[model samples]
Target: MSLEVTVVQACLRSGRGGSRTAVVEDGDLSDAARRTVPGAVGASQAVFIAAQDPAAVRLRFFTSTGELPACGHGTVAALAVLAQRSGNDRYDGVLHSTTRSLPGHAIGNAGHYSAAFEPGPIDLRAATIEEADPILSALRVSAEVAGCHVASVGRPRLLVELADRQTLANLAPDMPTLQAVTDRLDLLGCYVYVTPSSDGHTVARMFAPSIGVPEDIANANSTACAAAHLSTRGHSKLQVDMGDSLGQPATMTATVTGSPGTPIVEVGGTATISGRHHLD
Candidate 1:
């Protein structure tokens, strides 16, 4: 298949885009970086990257299975392009992105080199023991999880609040077993969160062994907002740190009044562009 790609050189600042705006389309996105990064198509295929800004980004990888809801790295790359195109303070309004605009669930903002797109604020609600079992096994998260809930915005993330930052950072799941479990259960992926004893920001890691993407996502925009959306009901200001684990170490900040169920959830952060390229 011929691969269609749009490359942009850009920067990202903060506070931009709503929840369903901004998009980029790549005719062919390979799964090379899957698992190592938070988001992206798992196999070689056509991909659509859409964002809501400073908060959530969703990716629909048209696959044999169906349209995959979210992709992390692809979101980062798209924001890089948006940021490069519009530099400076917040950028709003309906603008043409690298890909064609998607109606309903698409809107966003731009910054120096950073862009944040929101999705329907992350909502953490209920889940059954059977639904939660696979995740526990996948992350090798043998112990029990507190404040566990079914979370989603762009992509479905099983939010598991660990005991401490130690457990959050030290996620050692059996990839083979976890993947088998999630696939059978029909889940997109799993993300674990933890609040530090004393904080600057929130720390989290995602494992989607089922879809074949492993641990480590630099900074998944959608997942970042999802985590914040879950915390706002009880806390204020969520700072997310996902460094080398996902390839690019970055920070995402979310401030709002509710978690997932709130009427509104806004997320913002700095996005830095590595560079640009013209696909061959």
Candidate 2:
């Protein structure tokens, strides 16, 4: 048996840099075969479209190590592929994953594509001092932090705020300890960021060694979490800049509407098809 995989760069910064994702449209793979796609293609994550309908699409996400409940950038990559294949400039419908469903849409024309989705249920709360200590220590910084909180939009991620971009740039986390701390706290990863700049652009980085991705070039869900965290303090719309640390600089936008505590979060970014491959 053979499968076709489309590689896409999602959440591109100026149509140039983004995270590499593998998208498989075929739904005939066994669970065992599906798990091998990410590793085979050297992609951090893979999205499988199990079913597609006029009104809804069912998707499954996987990393080399295990299945993921949800994946933001992967979702974007999948939708962009769908939009391009359909020969439509815009595509909109519900997106169903194993854990939940949400409305999503994609738009494309002339070789450019972008997608967005609402990840249901947003949660944010300050981390207890005890919890913050280990995380900060693992990150190897102190006193330069402005705030720290645990935020989630489906999966929990620790949101750490630094005082300036230099601190963010100089981050050299203890990967082993950070992985241990995230595992202990039941966190997907830690998202450390500096506040928005004069132009409302938030620069950030995501680390999740526990999941085999020591550093993520682009993390849409974490950006959504950052939006939710900042919404509570009055900033509702902003763009997050990530991946520069890895030299694959990517960008994603998060918009928080409705209200502060109960805000609705939507994340969007553009993607481009980089290549394709056949696997057996």
Best by TM-score: 2
Candidate 1 lDDT tens digits, 172-276: 888887777777766666767775434535677767655545654433544545545455545555666654353445556655554345545445454433322
Local accuracy of candidate 2 as per-residue lDDT tens digits, 205-241:
9999888899999999888888888887777887989
In angstroms, give how far residue 132 of model 1 lies from its true place.
1.9
- Please list the Cα RMSD from the true structure of every candidate, rounded to 1 decimal place: 7.3, 1.5
Kindly provide the TM-score of model 1 when superposed on the true structure, using C-alpha atoms: 0.66
How well does candidate 1 score on lDDT at residue 49? 51
Show model 1 residue runs off by greater than 4 Å.
1-67, 86-90, 94-112, 121-123, 196-200, 219-229, 258-261
lDDT of each: 0.49, 0.86
